[model samples]
Target chain A: MKIITTVKELKEYVKNIDKSIGFVPTMGALHQGHTKLIKQAREENEIVVVSIFLNPTQFLKGEDLDKYPKKDEADKKICQLSGVDVMFFPSVDEIYTDDEVSILAPCVRGFVLEGFSRPGHFNGVLTVVMKLLNIVNPTRAYFGKKDAQQLYLIKLMARQFFMSVQIVAVDTQRESDGLALSSRNVYLSKEERQEALKIPQSLHLCAKLVSKNIRDRDEIVQKMKEILNPLELSYVEILNRNFEVIKEVELGNSVVLVEAKVGSTRLLDNIWL
Target chain B: MKIITTVKELKEYVKNIDKSIGFVPTMGALHQGHTKLIKQAREENEIVVVSIFLNPTQFLKGEDLDKYPKKDEADKKICQLSGVDVMFFPSVDEIYTDDEVSILAPCVRGFVLEGFSRPGHFNGVLTVVMKLLNIVNPTRAYFGKKDAQQLYLIKLMARQFFMSVQIVAVDTQRESDGLALSSRNVYLSKEERQEALKIPQSLHLCAKLVSKNIRDRDEIVQKMKEILNPLELSYVEILNRNFEVIKEVELGNSVVLVEAKVGSTRLLDNIWL
Candidate 1:
């Protein structure tokens, strides 16, 4: 597996290849979730290119910008084991410059859920994603649904900008006990780890309620709030594919999302109905 | 020549072409200046794609977006005469959606000169340019130095975004009397047209002064201002390629720019030293 660092070198490498490329961009903790995305990319394309960069712009001033998890050696091994053709490891300077033009997230959709909790987060994600997409010039790029809003915003960006690459949304990977896998999962204490399970449990309860013909959004949300009782809840939203809130759940077209704080760590989980 | 009205059609046409594409994006009302850019693109690449989009975002609320020149049939004829391979003409609705992601101009550089006079103008120009560039996916794009800041900002955007297309800057096309050609020139009445001559004359005088070893920026600007006296001057400053104000004119690295209002129509002219 080739390990590329600079933008110029990676671009040159992509330019010479005649085959279709599949890209999976990550911040690199080499968790099971990342491996799942890499595996899907590897299966679908002639070449799989994975990127591991802890983009600074996505984090707010007080957020975990400095302490975001990093496991570079393990991440390299994971990509090699998952059959990634190239692992692009660009420095912050390679991706960003001083006082450059920036991308702004959508006013409404980009400010809800994760965007609300962390304002300007999508801007950083989008700016970096655009840079990476242009650099890799992949045929199709894979993004896990774990960062659901990020995936939606990326799709919106692709359509809005008329980018050629297909954005493929992968299913969210989860732990056996139903905690959705996240790089920040490491930040959870033993007690917090158990509390994190409520996130998925609330989402599952929403799914179960929907299956039982409970279609009203308020009732579903009310039941969900109860399931998420005692935790510092950020939001529990029921929205359509476009992120617009719907009064009633429409199966296959609805997404029920939940976000709550587990001790000092914030966790989010959702189910597409 | 194929005329594409939809983003989907343009993307489809570009996808089938195996040859290199050269693009020139315009807002219709094609004049000698636009033709010069298109001609350069046609000569330099296997295919030439020109877009006529009157992007609304670039215009401030009270600006000439409504009254701005539109010579659609004439523009089509000019492109046909100039051997353009594809002409993309998209509607406002087709180009923009509700509360979409946007491009913000550079904090400092984007707010000076043209950006200073027309705040958020480069942001609009860049947002549309980025969209069009992605849609056409050209090999090399062409822009006239007539709109010097626009060209510079675009080159900056291409580099900053890691866009692979080469940006070829064409020389400023001018009238016999050195009045820079512009679509807005049509708005100038007969007497105003004569007054516009001083805009370029001031730039030329700066060049002549620089040639005579008039290296002081203030001295050069002062001389140019005397020549531009009595006209509503927007700005008459000199700066280097990086848009930094240099005390002394550095030949081959400096640009002398002038923006003056000939009656109500604002005209911009610049000379690369």
Candidate 2:
């Protein structure tokens, strides 16, 4: 359980190792979701690396870049208990310079749904992910399905760039009550916590409708919006797996994505049928 | 030399070999300059791979993409003669799809000099280079110093992204008459060919001034401009090795770059001190 903080050290360390490495990249505040990713990485490879850097670029000007949670000791403990070989906990300055290369998301897929409200969000995610992937050079990288759009875009980037690393998508880890686990879940007050359940509850309802062969996109969205009533809803999109808008849901190929603001914290949850 | 036309095949081929590879990426119509890069790649590593891709993204909307020169058979012969182990020649469709990930250049370093005249040019160059580098995953990649800014940006990108590939800068290959070798020299007619001599001649004068201990940037640029007179000069500037404008040339670190057009064909030449 070695903790490395600089990109150079991580690169050198990863370079010297001869085993196949599995990588899990995350922002700090390790929780059940992150534990799930690390546990899976531990199972799959001779070496497992987990990077916990709070990326600043991914946050917009008004977003909570400063208030992002940090639990370094707990994260380190999690990685150690998960059998992780190395933990990359780089500083913001170490990861980004004043002037450096950046990655841009595709216009269509990147500018819809999550991207519409939070423009340039994926660009930052992609830029940091690329930096981490290049630094680690892992054999396989684990990404949770909780950030469904981010996962899809990462997989797209890996293929489009012909990257050698295999991107593996782990299922979304959720609470027993069906609320998808997120680090920001802590931002919720007692009442807001109960309110946040509407997000996952909406998705659960959409899944039930989808299971019942309710394939119409409009009907599904309308029903989910009812479940999300009075919440500060950003969007309820029914799109194919490719992120393209479809007239109707195609079972096993469609995704019902929801983004809502519970109190001041924004949460994203989706069901990939 | 074995030629690979698809990304999948090239990845598989490069993956099976367990030797250090040196890569040189080109836009075909190989001249003495490309020959120098490939030849250097040949000497440095156990395996040498050359990619001949005329990346369309690097060309601007009104640029001569259609008129860009291509001599595939001759280029192949040159690669074979130069002892290249693998030649990757991918079609536009094979390398790119309708939707894909792209790389963006840094604002200051990317938008000056050549970048100013041709906006968004470095974006295209950086994007394609990233793709090719990922696909090949070579130990060392070769670039010429003629396109000084491009070389700098690519090196910066590799560093900023923590790319595994080592970017090695080769000196500019020149003709006996001091003209920098370029594939676009074919676009020059007999008269325009001689007119193109002014570009290198201007750089030669700039270097001669620096050798005489005359370090004033204005004086050096003025002298070069005199030699480049009546040639439809685009720009004559002096800057530090880091692309910053310098009042006085730094004895150990400076570059004098020139970009001018002859009969609507752009030519670039520079000297590094």
Candidate 3:
């Protein structure tokens, strides 16, 4: 596998490949979730490109911009083992410059859910994703359903801007205990790791309720809240595919999302019905 | 020349043609200025595509969006005569949707000169241009130096996003009477038309002074102001290519810009050294 760091090199490397290309963009410190995305991309395309950038703009001022985990050596090994054709690890300076044009998230849809909890986060994500998409110019780009809101926003951007690449959303990967795999999982202590399971447990309960014909959104949320008792819950929202809150859950279109604090780290999990 | 009114048709048409594409985006009302851009695109690439979209987002609430000139029949004839391969004329609905992801201009460079007069104008321009560029996926894109700030911002967006298309800046086109050619000129009465000539006249006077080795920015602006007297002047400033106000003009990097209101219509013109 080729390891590239600069945008120019990556562009030159991908410019001549005539085969169907698939791209997977992520931050470093790869986990099972990232592996799932890469494996899916490998299965679907003749060439798979993975970008690992810990973008600073996505982190708020007091957020974990400085302390975010970076496992560069292990990530390279994982990509090599996962059949990645190229692994892009660009430095901040190589990808961005001072006083540049930025991409903004959708006004309404981008400002709710994850955007509400972390304002301006999707803006940074959209901006960086746009740059990566332009540089890669892949035939298809892969995104995991774990970041459901992000996947939706990216789909919106691609359609709005008329980008040519197809966005392929892979299913979310989970642990044996039903906890969604996240790079941030490394931040959890032994005790806090056990508490993080409650996040997915709450989402699972909501999914079970909806599957059993519990159509009322309020009732589903209330039941999930009860199961999430004693934990500092950020929000338990029942939203349609567009992230708008709905009164009744539409079987195939509904999503139940939850966020909570486990120790000092925040965990997010969602179930798309 | 084929004329396409829908995005889907345009994309399909362009996809079948296996040749290098050069694109020029405009807002109908073809004038000598627009022809210069289209003509250059035709000369440079195997296929040339022109789009006429009167973007509403670029116009402020009370701006001249509705009053903006539209000469569709004339524009179509001009495109055919200029040897354009494809002319895309998408309606407002075909080009825009309810909520969208937008492109914001660079902080400092995007908010000066014309951007200063119209606060969010560049944001709209950049957003639409981004959409058109993605839709066309051209080998090269052409813009007239008549809209100097807009050209600079587009170039910046292409580079900042690592977009692959090459941007070519065609020189400004003028009439026999020295008035800068603009579609908006149709809004000017005969009297207002005569008054518009002073804009380019003042800019020429500044160019003559700079040729005589008068390099001070303020002195040249003051001299141009003398010639623009009795007219409602918006601004007359000199800046470097980076759009920063310079104390002394560097011969190859200087740009002298002027904006003035001829009756109710505001006009802009610039000379790049």
Candidate 4:
């Protein structure tokens, strides 16, 4: 696999190839979730390009901007093993400059759920995604549904901007114990790791309740809060695919989302109905 | 020439072609300046696309959005005569949706001259430009140096975002009497049109003084203001190409800009050193 670190070189590398490109953008410290995304991209296109950038703008001040995990050697190995054609490992200077153009997320949709806790987080996420999309000019970009809101907003951006790239959402990768895989998972201590299981357990219960047709928004939320009790819960929302609040779950169109702190690390998990 | 009105149709139309495309985005009332831009695009590319969108977002409330002159039929004829391959004319609904993604201007550069009077104006210009560029996916996008600040910001955005499209700045077009061509010139009455001559005259005087090796920014600005006297002046700034205030004008790297109201119509003019 060819590794490119500068935008000019990567753009030059991709410019001449007239084949379908599938791109997977992620922060380093690749996990099973990232592996699934890359594997799916590999299977779908003639070229699969993976970008590992720990975007600083996405992290709010006092957040884990400094301590975010980095596993460069392991990530390169993983990309090679997964059949990635190109690995883009750009430094912050290569990707961003001072007083540059930025993107603002959708006002209403962006300010809810994950957005509420981290106010301008999606701005950073969408800005970096946009820059990467332009740089790669990939035919299809793969994003896991694990970051459901981010995926949705990205798809929205592609559609609204009339971008040629097709956005594909892969199913979330999970542990045997049902905990969603996340880079932040490494930050949890042994006890916090065990407590993190409650996050998915709560989602599993919500899924079970949903399967049993007890999908009333308030009732399901109440039960979810109960399952999530004794742990600090940020929010538990039951919304439609449009990210709008609904009275009851609409099968195949609802998403139940939850966020909580395990020790000092925050984890996100959700189920697409 | 084919005229595409919807983003879907336009994207589909441009998807498979294997030729260079040159794009010119404009709000209608296509005058000599737009014709010059389109003609340059036609000469430089295999396909030339001209988009006429009177973007409302760029216009502050109570601005000239409604009164901004529309010469659609004339503009179409000009594009056809200029050898344009496609004309994209989209309505507000086709271009924008509720609370969607947006682009914010760069902090310092975006807020100086044009952005100063119309705060958040570049945001709208960039949002639409970004959308149009993505829809057209041109090889080269053309902008007139007439809108110097806009051109600079667009170039900055393309560079900052690593956009593959090459931004080509065409020379500014002017009227016989030395006034910079603009659609807003239509709002000028016969008397006001004559008064507007002082704008270019001031710039001409500044250029002549600089040619005589009088390069002090403050002295030149003061002299230009004397010539622009008794006209409601907005601002007159002489600065380096990077938009920073410079004490002395560098022969090849300075720009003298002027903005003033001619009977309540705001007009802008500039000279690139």
Please, what are the lDDT tens digits per residue for candidate 1 over residues A145-223? 8778899999999999989899999999999999999988999999889878888989999988888999999999999
Q: For candidate 4, write residues A1-273 as lDDT tens digits.
A: 999999999999998898999999999999999999998898889999999999999999999988999899999999999999999999999999999899999999998989999999999999999999999999999998988899999999998998888999999999899889999999999998988888898998999998898968999989988878778888899889988999999999998999999888899999999
Candidate 3, residues B156-267, lDDT tens digits: the string is 9999999999999989899998888888888999998988888999999988998899998889889999888878877888989988899998999988999999899898
Tens digit of per-residue lDDT, candidate 4, span B1-273:
999999889988898798999999999899889888988888899999999999998999989887889989999998899899899999999999997999999999999888999998999999999999988989999998878889999999999998889999988899989999999998999999999999999999998998899988889999999989889887899878888889999988988899899998999999999
For model 3, how does the per-residue alpha-carbon lDDT over A1-273 read when each residue is reduced to its tens digit?
Answer: 999999999999888788999999999899889999898899989999999999988898899878889899999999999999999999999999999899989889988878888999999999999999999989999988878889999999999999999999888899999888888888899988988888888888887887798889888888888888878877889889977889999988977888888888888888888
Cα displacement (Å) at residue B31, model 3: 1.0
The candidate with the higher lDDT, 1 or 3, is 1
Mark the 10 consecutive residues where model 1 chain A has the least summed lDDT.
A262-271
Show where candidate 4 strays beyond 4 Å: none
Q: Write the per-residue lDDT of candidate 2 for residues A74-166, one digit (tens) a residue.
A: 888888888888999999889888777899999889888888889999999999999999999999999999898999999999999998899
Top lDDT model: 4
lDDT for model 3, please.
0.90
TM-score of chain A of each: 0.99, 0.98, 0.97, 0.99
lDDT accuracy of residue B11 in candidate 2: 91
In CAPRI terms, model 1 is classed as high
**Which predicted model would earn the best DockQ?**
3
TM-score for candidate 1:
0.98
DockQ per candidate:
0.86, 0.86, 0.92, 0.89
